[model samples]
Target: MLAERPWTGYGFESFWGTPLLLNQDQPFDRAWDIRTIVHGHNGYLDIAVLMGIPALCVAVYTFLVAPLRDYMRIPLRKENIHLGDFFMMVVLFAALNAFFESFFFHRADPVWLFFVFGMFGLRQVSLRPMAVRGRS
Candidate 1:
């Protein structure tokens, strides 16, 4: 059982237990990236890129779609928000992300998981029926 332990010191090269993105002296390449799966460290930039996609999706729906309904005189909050539609969109985005990741990267990265969860929250917030008060 002792043989199972990683003694090459390649296990933990960074803070805590995980390596700092790639090893300190490793080089990054597009061709290599296309062939292998290695988690690289982008610091906080990675977080922004991962979180930005769902936020932009929600922002577009809110600022563009929601306001257009107002100009078109569509009812704002009268009818209940359709739960099925919201759930379907979230599933669609998640599936798309998964399929693309699997095809190109050969594995579903944790970033995709974050995008899926973020999409759910975004749709729920954007599709919520807001109460509109009448003009006094």
Candidate 2:
């Protein structure tokens, strides 16, 4: 299905919902049945299959790259270090989980919510100054 339309993709929920799209010519001895699979089980592949490679690229940057860049900039001070560390763990957890689960951008999902929250926290921490000194 993805091979047939790599650029355009099969659209949302088309993976298992569209049986006609599956390769009907496959041998009966095949190990896995494409029809039985609902989601790609991988966030990146799900995005590519649901939308397209372009959308996958955008999602990758938005969800992974941008947040990581912000995380790197957050100051490691005693006051805000915990904030940065906690959010970093959340980002890492989401990133690692994306490989095994397809819950990347689901707005209602807790994983997605925490991931977004982590991004927001990282951004806020990155933007603020580490310390301030008063002048006489």
Clashes of 1: 2
Number of the top TM-score candidate: 2
Model 2 lowest lDDT segment of ten: 15-24
Question: CA shift at 124, candidate 2, in angstroms?
Answer: 1.5
| Model 1 pairs whose backbones collide | 21-40, 21-41
- Top of the candidates by lDDT: 2
Candidate 1 global CA lDDT score: 0.38
